[model samples]
Target: MKKQQSQWTHREKSFSAFVTGPLLSFWRQRQERQFVGKEGVVIRYMRMTAAAHKKAILVVPGRSESYIKYPEVVWDLFNCGYDVFVIDHRGQGLSGRLLDDSQLGHVAQFSDYVDDLETLCELELSGSRYHQTFVLAHSMGGAIATLLSQRHPSLFTATALVAPMFGIVLPMPEWVVERILNWTATRPHLREGFAFGTGRWHATPFGINNLTHSRVRYQRNLRFYADQPELQLGGPTTHWVREAIFTGRYIESIAPELHHPVLLLQASEDQVVDNQAQDRFSLARNLAGFPCYGDHPQVMEGARHEILFEKDEIRAEALQKITEYFLTFNPNTV
Candidate 1:
């Protein structure tokens, strides 16, 4: 099928060029709307299509994220000859907020996200006429995708995880600290807040400076932040951290049950999730005779937490590798 290039304004072009290199060879306009779930929660998504494409890739964003934060990724997937659908996780982006008061953005459990994804897949993507459907998730979204793959293996053809938050790289005493914090957060007087090392609430110009390979790419992301101040999200609360710990443990225990083909992309220099834990999980899955654990697992050197938002060349290469893997596994569809 032939692909068409979507028009972009000068500002948008500058933004895309700064983040994606010279010019985007394959770009498409996106349509945004809400995918209603059970219990009246609306999951917001942005979808882009290629002409005559029969396969679709559903992208799940991480914590404090919105669909607009992933323009580069959406464009790349469109170029790769597949329809791309990006969903804003519940309590983030344009989705339903968790807390009504000051804690509106905070989540009490990671399983809540898993439930949202399950509903999104079954109710949203199940009836679509695409020949093949897959999921591509990053960080926290990666964790949810892993859980979803285990819980609903038949819904997706495969999954690609970028810097998935399977576990944390904390000091030995950190576990004790987390337990104490969790207990304390339940107190009547103590208000819940984020844990240590999470990013600040204010969007700083320097936030992506150190993590990205290109200054222009970082600047472009900064511009997006400047334009959309409301999309900024704070760190996880104490309850969120506690729930994440439990979720990580649960996923680890059930890793053997996942039968869907999985591609795990680990950043060698990731400061967020524990890369060692991801490696160990992959190794254990191989040793335990898991069918889909041996799929291509690559650790990109000098990459940070946000692989999709990295420098133009680096991000493009990473996306290429992902698209290649997807096409190789399911060539009959794409």
Candidate 2:
């Protein structure tokens, strides 16, 4: 069979509305599938195929992101001779929502995301023609990927974490934040406010947004949510904040045991996750004379939290580095 080709390129001078538009006629559209996650929650996913490629890239998106937001990314990978798989985690995107208010972001525990991802892999990826698998995770998804790596050491050949959430950069002190989270999580009916005073189901104007430097890319994403209100979600809940804190600490404990080659891509101007935490994890071996576990850290200067949504020059470089990292480890790469 011949490989499917895409007309998309990362070298575009600006994000093309034609490419990122709702129609998506030029790109191969992914058929949505559902899997039963832990406790019978339904998780939604989409897989894009490259008929002749034997390698696959599994993309795990961050909070409030759905597979629809990543058509350009999927097209880019498919054109580079790899299959692409992306999913909307439970309680976000098209997946099942936890709270009665679908717009409210909520998760009782972070491990539920891990369970959902494992189910997707078993149902879709096991024993497939794509022999080697790589992961490209962003933000919170990066945390999920790291936890998966610690638990299943041999699952992925290599991984790239873009602006991984090792630690969240909150305004208050860590102790005070933890205290508030603990109290709110334990409270039965007193916790419904959005974290950091962000309102429910609200959109920020491009001028005040800190997500990405590219107005074109930012507007494109906003358009997606505007068209499909169901896919849009707001700030994290108290339970979610508590669970994430626990998961972050767990990852730190097992960081020394992770043997997989990981590329930790840190954004220099990231206002979401703590850059100092990423630095500590990346340089743990050098600083403490501990055994190295292939933690390679690369910084994207002047980029914000969402490096993938930044200006074309920055996005291009980041994608190139990610593609190179995966290709280097996949023996089938030509």
On TM-score, the candidate that comes out on top is 2
**CA lDDT of every candidate:** 0.70, 0.78
Query: Per-residue lDDT of 211-248 in model 1, one digit per residue for the tens?
Result: 56655556666666568765556776666766776777
lDDT of 2 by residue, 1-334 (tens): 0132212233345347556463387354677888878777789999888578788889999988999898878877777777889989989998988888887788878988988888777776778677788889999999998888777878888888999987887778989988887777656554654675655776789998878888888888899899999998988876777777777777776676677778878888899888887776776634544433344468888799999878777777788778777767753564
Clashing pairs in 2: none
Residue 312 displacement in candidate 2 (angstroms) = 0.8
Best by lDDT: 2
> lDDT score of model 1?
0.70
Q: Candidate 1: where is the Cα deviation over 4 Å?
A: 1-28, 36-39, 100-105, 188-191, 196-200, 207-210, 291-296, 332-334
Candidate 1: pairs in clash: none
